[model samples]
Target chain A: MRIAFIIIAIVFVALTIAFTILPMGTIALIPVALAFLFSFFAFFKSKERKRIFSKWLMFFVFVLFLVIVAKDVFVKDKVVTDQKFQLEKQNSQQEAQKELEELEGLK
Target chain B: MKKILTIGVFLSFIRICTGQISPNETLIFDGSYELSGMMTNIAQVTMQTSVMKTTNKSYLHLSAEVATFNKWDSFFKIRDLYESYVDPGTLKPSLYKRNVYEGGYTKTEKYSYNPAGNSIKSESKRKNNPVVKNTVSIQPGAVDVITLIYKLRSANLSGLKAGQSIPYIIVFDEKQLRVNLKMLGKEIVSAGNLGKRECYKLSISANTNKLKGADKNLIWLTTDSKHIPCLIKFSIPVGVGQLSLLKTAGI
Candidate 1:
């Protein structure tokens, strides 16, 4: 059980680096969530509860990582989509104005 | 015999380097570009253009892999591909298609031009969205973005003055945009591995809000019958992106 937790923790750190350096988008969230589960096991099921400072530390780190990933997946994505919508709206307005100017030139 | 062999090799080398584009022949351009902002490289861009021999169609493909040097990765990895089937006799596009991917968003569009009706029927499909159908009016000889690049190659610009501007229309993303190309005279510019060459300097301005407060996009085309696009510089929301021709083939 301890070995499994150590392995998951290592995978979690590697995925964090990968997510930071690459445009993996929501794909990065899968590993982050899995790490969170492993951290929970480390905190509760580890045999060396008295000397398990590293397990508790990893648990907190995984929690923080989960928050960041959730914010990116839920909040940042929505903001980007909103900005694109606004840009499209502005473009349509400009197109209409240009058409009006052309009509006036013809008249 | 030695002299003849040397001359033949030299002629072939020239042909390979310049890829002398002719009206009746096809040409291909393969190149890479760099996008930078705030004095830092932000992305690597790859571009390829080829003319299909079987269908006589011209295709341009561009992809950008955004870097994560800023700690946070870019939200988008962009890919844009355009294909146009040109009428060999008229050099005008009869059909056009565009496939675009930016981050998680994707859209595919097909346009059919009807010269008889002076209109174009556009069909676009977005991810998880209903298909969009629209018909837009077009001017005579109006082309799409991809076709416009090739059309300008075959166009006669000898009569254009240094400060003169030519008006053209292009249909893109369901919008018929009026674009003006202003001649900024001719100058010698670097052509990467090809070294320096004389090129026609031109600036593009379009009737759109997206270009507000941005410098007009600049283009340098070779001042020859080939009329290859040697260099292009355009401003993005952040800074600028430059696309330069790196090599040519199949001319």
Candidate 2:
């Protein structure tokens, strides 16, 4: 039972990490919610040492999820937004220049 | 001089009212296409466009779904929905909404245009992040991506000769972009279930290299007054994607 719990915890953490890195958006919440539910189940089903281990693992997973969410909300999103704005600005200016050239040629 | 000015004003008002499609007219088009790569169908696309009136204002709704199926099960899905409220007289969009679900990720964007200030207030939400708010300046008569499509359909393209281009501005994903559509003359193009019809080809392009593989996007619209899009062909990194008109109604 202890081995199974460990495997499940590891898999859940890996999935959380993968989803966070990818562009899965709010779908990452599924694994996080599952991990929380599993931890709660393990806490009641196991005894003594196993219970303590499950508690610590759940805390670790929760923290990791928070970190991932923070990075996305504070860092990655801003970077992407800025890049998109810059690209659009460049494209608009280029088009304006082309229009000017076309008018000049007509003249 | 005063009499002449009054006559010119009356004529301009008449022109404005008759310039585009009547406010009561509605147009709807339904279509499907296959996206293939390496001689195999990788994804199937279904698209629909509805232009109608809502409480004295014209509204356009566009929805598209792309899905990949494996036998009886579906493996991948992407859904995009766009809604735009346009001013009937000026054909300018007042509000635009975009909701997209790609794979498992979901995003929603809403834009409210303040024509008096020549700016757009955008609210965007991705996944579970808090809504990001921004206000961006815009040019006069600027429209969103979906609205631009309908605007093109209603525009007066009769004066445009072969090789002539029309420039327009579009607000997409919180950024303003300038796009030019170059008329490529008329040709007969296959439009899937709609069959073969004479269409006016137009090339669409932006000024940025970001389009890379998707550069040279082309669309063919029917020559009739309805001006329905018959076929849209564009190249991707892997292969070409074509969306042809399968059915249309209420033009």
- The prediction achieving the highest TM-score against the true structure is 2
Q: Calculate DockQ per candidate and list them.
A: 0.02, 0.01
Clash pairs of candidate 2?
none
Each prediction's Cα lDDT score?
A: 0.59, 0.63
Name the regions of candidate 2 deviating beyond 4 angstroms.
Answer: A1-107, B1-73, B192-194, B213-215, B236-239
lDDT per residue (tens digit) for residues B138-177 in model 2: 8877788776776787766778899899999888877778
The window of 10 residues in a row where model 2 chain B has the poorest summed lDDT is: B31-40
Candidate 1 residue lDDT tens string, B1-251: 99999999977654543343343333222222332212222333333343333222332321121222222225444444455655443456656666665666788787777745378778899988998999888877688877677666655566788989888888878788998888889989877556788999888888876553433588888887677677877764555556655554433
Task: Compute fnat per model.
Answer: 0.00, 0.00
Consecutive 10-residue window with the lowest summed lDDT within model 1 chain A: A76-85
Candidate 1's residue-wise lDDT over A49-100, tens digit each?
Answer: 5427546657655665776576455643211133443464345334433432
Give every collision pair in model 1: none
Candidate 1, residue B6: the lDDT equals: 100
